[model samples]
Target: MRREGSKAFYIHTFGCQMNQADSAIITSLLQREGYHPAENENDAGIILLNTCAVRENAVDRIEHYLQHLQGMKKRDKGLIVGVAGCVPQFQREEMFTMSPAIDFLAGPDTYRTLPLVIEQARAGIRLASLEFNAAETYEGIDPVREGLISAVVPVMRGCNNMCAFCVVPFTRGRERSHPFKSVIVEVQKLVASGYREITLIGQNVNSYSDPEDGHNFADLLDAVSSEAPMARIRFTTSHPKDISEALVRTIAERRNICNHIHLPVQSGSSRMLDLMNRGHTIEEYREKIALIRSVIPGVALSTDIIAGFCGEQEEDHQATLELLSAVRFDSAFMFFYSERPGTLAARTLEDDIPEAVKKRRLQEIIDLQNSISDKHYQDTVGTVVEVLAESESRRSSEQLMGRTDTNRVVVFEREHYQAGDRLNVLISSATSATLIGRPEHGVVQH
Candidate 1:
């Protein structure tokens, strides 16, 4: 499969862990066809943008990069550019017209045919495959590159919960879980490859139910933990209504599962919740959090919150602030609502939230989260925590950065340690976002 010239490719990934996993698959496909990975876009023969359509800002960033690539193509004249993921799925003809430099457009499911499409593009043909499929799964392909300590494995594709503001149901199609045996096989392979942590990924992870054998998400978690040799397990983007008692109990019993949950409470006001069609009220979210804490003591909780929606009033905004204060999450990913076309919200609701008000409310949410995060980290001072070394610190060469089982960042000065070592760190200082620590003892070599 080797080509004549030194064909190299670079992928710029944007958005959630699901997008990350798709990029990995695309990378694997390119490598299998004898393309080397380029360190940067300027030096590559091919460039691919794996895009996200969740936020308008993300779309803007991709367009900016496409403009830069267009200029680069004028200089090189041989660069083959492609667009993949949700943006291409949502905007096929528009994306091609928006950037004439783009040579191929492939969606999430069309990744298996990417090598062929790349060949076609090289032969002066524009290719696009945005069709959705419920039966396609790339479970057997080995990723060309993987992180040393952690990796994300997507166990399902698409979403069934049509949250009014979300375009995922439209862009990604219906929900389909990968076979349980296939998922376990992937986890086992990852463990054997020296990956210590694995995060099961999906658009709605908790809603994953095996149609073949009736094994639900909780059942899959228990099965994977029991069979796989990995040290830690985590999952993301859980819907509030889908969080079950059995899942909480399983987390409490499993010693290897990480004690962190990323349940997204988009808004706090009951009216706003109903408007968004999120299928759960604020009280239900609180009850779910309480159940998790009661079953698994000291569990770390994080969330996603939207500050302003179409018709959010001062009272609704206040409710969001109060929810933040009450939850006191370890961290949160906050954003101002941006309506996307083809979504329920865009079709039904008016985009009436003023930009200035949205910005003010978003800033207030950020400020409150900063205080809560600072308090949480400060309380961890002088406590010993286990950390998996991820990489060298960005600021200092003498320091190594890693994350605890609860996903808190720890920066420590340690010599003779590489990226994958698991070490015990004694916290010396704390900030809102990171903890400064030193090795409690000698670094534990893997």
Candidate 2:
């Protein structure tokens, strides 16, 4: 039976860049089946929450969001409420029990079955498709991207790392790289379509290996840069152990590759790292960081830090703080640990840290990072940096907002430029999070 409402769909994505890329693929698949994009939930017949399972609060947020959707379903009888991505894969039938409005559940690998699931849903059938596929790369599937200035191409899927605190291995399954030729083709297509920046995304992008040519992540990066010389290339979420010398060298040599690397060192203590099953110790991670900095001068380094983990001692916390002071990351994503279920940490270790202590440590981490970020941004005063103007600033349309090659946000007064125009800007003032600048004297629009 056909769905009994307008063929319009809305996806509220809540997660990392991988989820955003998945939403794009979902949009492409549904559009092929004649479904139009809806501006919001009220105007759509289908609403899918692409959820995350990394932290407990993320799942809680999605559950709370789903409970509020009951009113929308009451108003539109034919509305098909669904859940996709890591949350569905992890929660399974519990998602339906927790949120009764959900019509179907689809895992990361089962997105291709969405159209069929919707058809079954219209016939009063509720179901969950949570099977894992080792070889589902979704090759040749062109994403329906909305960005002209920047776009993300998922070069690979899943993770093999399986850190003790993470649920990705269970939710996203094993690592699988997209075919090399298909990835290059996607990059070429995006460049041809006028995309200025292309980010090759994955759970752990450094582990990407071409199935056909036995090529590695560095090889794939070299190929992408060679194929799309006009477009700037970037990648994310590199594992500390997987980062190779070749990868750092490739970034240094490639003129178009952005000079930013987001390498997540979850904790700073070697003992804490061992408890977390992080594979690499503090010394090894620091060595890798030193290597990256030496190879690529003036590279912007960012990281992820968890303040409190299972059995985290005060000494461990101090170690993280000391690491922050020593490394002085340009920025960081810091949070108190939220134990995820079914992970090695949850099953084996006790969530022993007191809530008060956790929050205090988190705040300390935040304050230290703020000061470090302030000093870094303040140093940028009177320097010239290249920025790709993305959109009008939120404060005023008279000002334009963009990002530097180091991934720093910059806002400057609007001149004759538009979105996607790359121009050099001379930094005049700055906040901890943003750089206020004006066009440079020799501004050349690319």
Candidate 3:
């Protein structure tokens, strides 16, 4: 179980919340086998890259990082280099050929077998574990918490929907919910450990269902809130078509559930939507948003928007802009589309959108969202909302930063406040992306 005389490993994660949750599981597994977490790559015996392949830019960054790790390996021969998560799942043995410095490669489903792989790597064996496992949830594995403020707990894995631009279905495989009891147990543990927030993560969290236990996402949310009434509960990346009224109702009923939802609507035109195989039309997505707002009044909404796709036209871009004006999301994650390798789009469609056009469209989306976000922030000025203190403000040490239940960042003057305290903040100033506040007289309880 020992990696030479050293037992430290550092995992650098890329991609989404699912990958972050996977990194936590890997940390716990390695610790159980006597591996300590290294502070940095140079301090570690093993340097693990938990990669992403959703966009080509992320893959490019990984390739650059690999070169740095390889240079470090040349100076220190004892360092064990490895790659995990989505990138390795797709690239597999090709990654080994590309980066000979890597000693081990483990896929998202193959993390549990990593200890054996580490042993093989110790014996100078280059190893790769890229096979998919239908029933592996890392069920009994308890993730080691790195911080006490907030934690990402994965309730499920994989994706069943094959969005033409998506690489998740191929990398993470079909959807599978973890055992319901195990999920509740982890929530209880996090609450007991003084964590203030928990975001249930998955490729598409709305699809969580366990037929044997007769439990769905709504049931799980109820159980978690019932188990840890003081912890702020949240979940992310809900599929537009699958988001239910029951889920929205559950949030309304619970005082601790965050009043925010991130439902990604990649395109606004029906033609473009069908081309991407998103499984939901613009009208249907509009209905889901309407339902969510009806159930939970004043709930902050956010979305993901792609500027260019395989055959995106000027009319399609105009349609997307119109949708932005209509929805007026509090915030958005926007990207100029990049077709991923091994995806349906890559195999069947041509990436014919000119780069200049994609960039222009993306900038337009950004400008529009910025205006909407500014209006939302200005509206919040003079309102008093609860904020869980997360850390010192990056802009100023004299201030502390936290988030409102709506998941908006609010920075306020630090006055006898700590990292975990919940404060009633009086919103005083507004920016496009942040709200500046001051602590009010009364405390806000979770």
The best candidate in terms of lDDT: 2
- Each candidate: what lDDT? 0.87, 0.91, 0.90
lDDT of 3 by residue, 1-446 (tens): 22454788999999877888889899999989988899887778988999999988889999999998888877887888889999989987898876778899999999988888988898999989999998988999998767789998898899999999999999999899988889988888888888889999888998899746969898988888888888888899899988888988999999889999999998889999999999988999999998998999989999999998989999999999999999889999999998788899999999999999999999999999999999999999999989999999998889999999899999998988878889899999999989998999756764
Between candidates 1 and 3, the TM-score winner: 3
Q: What is the lDDT, from 0 to 100, of the residue 279 in candidate 1? A: 90
lDDT of 2 at 419: 79
298-404: candidate 2 lDDT, tens digit per residue = 99999999989989999999999999999999999998998888999989999999999999999999999999999999999999989989999999988899999
Instruction: Score candidate 2 by lDDT.
Output: 0.91
Clashing pairs in 3: none
TM-score of 2: 0.98
For model 2, the run of ten residues with the poorest summed lDDT? 437-446
Q: Candidate 2 — which residues are off by over 4 angstroms?
A: 1-3
TM-scores of the models, in the order given: 0.96, 0.98, 0.97
